[model samples]
Target: MKKMKWALLMVVVLVLAACSTEQPGSKSSSDNEDAGKDGDKEFKIGLSVSTLNNPFFVTLSEGAKEQAKESGAKIIVVDAQDDASKQASDVEDLIQQGVDLLIINPTDSEAVVSAVESANNSNIPVITVDRSAEGGEVVSHIASDNKAGGVLAGEYLLELLGENAKVAELEGIAGSSAARDRGEGFNEAVDGKVDIVAKQTANFNRAEGLTVMENILQANPEITGVFAHNDEMALGALEAIQSAGKDIVVIGFDATDDAVKSVKDGKLAATIAQKPEEIGKKAMEAAVAVLNGEDVDADIPVDLELIKE
Candidate 1:
């Protein structure tokens, strides 16, 4: 009888252990691991935008947010306001929120490395959109070919201006990959063919673009063409040129709404369309793939096109 009682107690203990392992709130190591799989728990994604002040970044954010809703995923977007330190702080806040994945559009490539490394330390996958981070592990990068877009702008400008055409370049923010790569490709295409009269950094702001272009115009009065790293600067430069009563062929990058309207109105010459919305959608898709533990391309390239009226 004693032996029977001992066996019954052991069985009861084993049953209780089994039940405890699968309690109402307990999750197994493999349970709800793949967010893309059916009936799994929803995944949370964090997006760090450089700045939403620009229409380009605003459209990009809209695309990502829309796709997140469609995919039944939660997304948190933080704007850096073009401040690198603010971006870093935003990323730390995202990390504290326990987001499953991170997508960053860096204000500066080098400044974003520490933020990326922080996500890496927490074992969270990262994807960079529009601009790149200079260091750390990233699951994927989604952007248009900035260098190729620059080359397109250069080639088109040369076609319009012909030989010996003097041009001024309005550069984007310093230490940004988009600025560097675009400048490289533009220089490669126009070197020895055209004279770049004045090149200045406008920090990708319209006000600064106008001020810098005003300065360049004052210094180099004979320039006939201009190539701005982005449309904001291009539009600003156009304003300065119009005010100075100069007829310069201004080519810009990123066909933002204002730039497109300017082109249509014959106020701006041309622009390279980076398709910021597509880039955002692609970044969101990559985030989902990373959360699903699926393999994704290291570099995802969106198509680019030149827009002119």
Candidate 2:
């Protein structure tokens, strides 16, 4: 009787141990499947931007994040700090990380082509924002009409000064498409009517704009108007004008909050507003469409508006 009782106890202990092992294993497998169903399966995207120092790009980043969260995709953002080589390296790292898509705001239009092409060869789609690559077949490009913004600035300046005023121009990055297009359009709109007294490249930086505008003021003190390619430069020019005790009319692009306030305070004349948020939202939406095997337009142009306080 004693031997039989011990055997029964041993059998019961072994059965309980076996049941415990199977239960945890089954639960773990189910948990892994749940992870996949919750869309946490490691879908990643790479976003390379020119700079995060600028408010415009900050807004763009926010918009992208909003859209990406809605689609359940993870985004890795890299700030190039306005350096082309750094941007290239960042993109390479993203490629190595096996990102599903690449979104770039090229610091230099032509410098980013090879990096984009590399991704293309690896079967990854590349999308451009604001700035474009010179010779690459990107999946999509989203931007505002920079040239039209410039033309609007030019026309507004001409109207303010009666089409025969002396004007100074503050240009952004020299080789950038935004700089070139805006300058060209402004020049065209005011062709043979207004005199462009000085045109200098401030590299789209505020401090540089202040120095450049000061030099222009010294060279041509009688200038009636100033046009800057971006709000940062425009604000700088405004400061220089105020410091020099000049009352020159100033107009800028990128209708940033500060720029709008300047206009309201009667310091700045007008500014063209580019919809950064809209650009960002649209880019993400386009990325989703591409992922879904749906066709998207090569160029998505966001509209611009001139804000005059």
Candidate 3:
């Protein structure tokens, strides 16, 4: 009788342990893990933007937000402030929130590999915008053909200034695909035709562009034209040119509103126009498509236009 009583106690304890181990508010994996699989349920998209300091990226975010509103989907935007580690951390937090899909604009291509891997592990599809990642499974990359735009700038500069004209280059941020590809295409187009007297990096910043261009002009005052990777740097170069009282033709990329106005005012010579809003909208749509299990291309190139007065 004592042995039976002890057995009963042991059984009760075991049952209590089992009950305590059960997760609180737990549901079946099938119900929670695949909520948006059929395209009927609302999707939650995670957007990781590199930085919002520039007006260009700010406009991109507005585009994404607009599309999300129209589709009745939820979007979470995280700013990395140009820090790779911060971006990775933001991505982890986004995954913990159970986002249905991810759209990443990496601060650095190689540095974002770990973040991409984490998303892959969580079984979430990734779509990169503006900049791309070196590793992980990216379903799609959406942006304009930066190299082609560079070629256009180079050809236009060549036409404006004779082949024998000397020129200086105001480069964009180092290690960015935009800077690398734009430089390559421009060099190829102007090969042996024009003299690149002074080429240096301005880090795709307006202040840096001003300082660097000023110094370059001091060394090679004969430079007749300039090719800046982006509009910010080009604007800086324009300011420096004006300060030096130099009649130099400056070409910029990414026709931001200010750049267009500058061109119209005869301050800046020309700029390349990229459909930034289109890129953002397409990226958001692609994330939705991935959630719905629809097909998508690896690379989607937006159209580019040359803006000049």
Candidate 4:
């Protein structure tokens, strides 16, 4: 009887040890499976924008957020309100958060380079949307072809003005990729063809556009047409033209709802329509691909449309 009891105790100890080791391994495998299915284990992205004040950027944000939700990834969105330093700080904060990917529409391309470098050092992939940083190897860049859109605007303006009219150009924020590229294309289209009497920068603001248009009008009273880099500035220029009692044809970009209505109402002539929602969707999709270790192109160009009424 003593031998039987000792044998039974030994059997029980062996059984318990076997159960303990098997249970932990099973649990670990189950946890790994759950992480894979839900993508909750190690996927996060960050999006930083110059400002949320513009409806265009707001739409972009909404699309990105929706896509991130569907992909089971966390996205941190930061708005810089057009402040370059704030944008840099926001990127730094996202980097510290250990994000797996970064998407940025920089306030100032040059100023955001260092912040992008910080993320690159951490092995995080960076994607630029709508705007680009000056010096960086971003995994992907998604935006409308601003230069092509500008050429379209110029050609449309020339057609509306009967091919020989004096025009004024209202530029966006200085030193921006959009501003430089769009101006280049516009000048190319209008070179030796039309009279660009005055050119000025409006910083892509409505009030500044109004003030700058007022100055241009003082210098060249016969300005028959106006070309603003964006619709907000175009609207401002329209207001200034109306206030000055001058009948001028105007063209703009980024056909916002207000700009579209203005075109319908005959207040503005035409605009180049860029699909902001599509831009947002593409950015998020590229981000997910990068997270999954898929290869993507460095530049993704969204097509632009010309809107006329």
Model 3: which ten-residue window has the lowest total lDDT? 31-40
lDDT (10s digit) by residue, model 1, range 170-234: 99999999999898889989999999989999988888889999999999999999999999999
Task: Write the residue-wise lDDT of candidate 4 on 1-309 in tens digits.
Answer: 999999999999999898875654365666655363254564678999888977778888888988877777778999989888898899889988888899999877788898888888888899999888898669999999999999999888888886668999999888678888788888888888899989999977788889999999999998899999988899999999999999999999888888999999989999888888888889998998888879998899998999999
Worst 10 residues of 2 by lDDT: 33-42
lDDT against the true structure, each candidate: 0.92, 0.89, 0.89, 0.87
lDDT of candidate 3 at residue 237, scale 0 to 100: 94
User: If ranked by lDDT, best first, what sequence of candidates would result?
Assistant: 1, 3, 2, 4
Ranking by TM-score: 4, 1, 2, 3
Query: Which residue pairs does candidate 1 place in steric collision?
Result: none
Per-model TM values vs. the true structure:
0.89, 0.88, 0.85, 0.89
- Give a tens-digit lDDT track for model 3, residues 1-309: 999999999999999978785487866566655344344577999999987876678888889988887776789999998788899999999999999899998877888999999999999999998777889999999988989999999999999997989998888766677888889889989999999999999877888999999999999989999999989899999999999998999999989888999999998989999877888898988888777789999999999999998
Best by lDDT: 1
Candidate 4 minimal-lDDT segment of 10 residues: 33-42
Reference-based lDDT, residue 287, model 1: 86
Could you tell me how far off, in angstroms, the CA of residue 195 lies in candidate 1 after the best superposition? 0.8
Q: Name the candidate that leads on TM-score.
A: 4
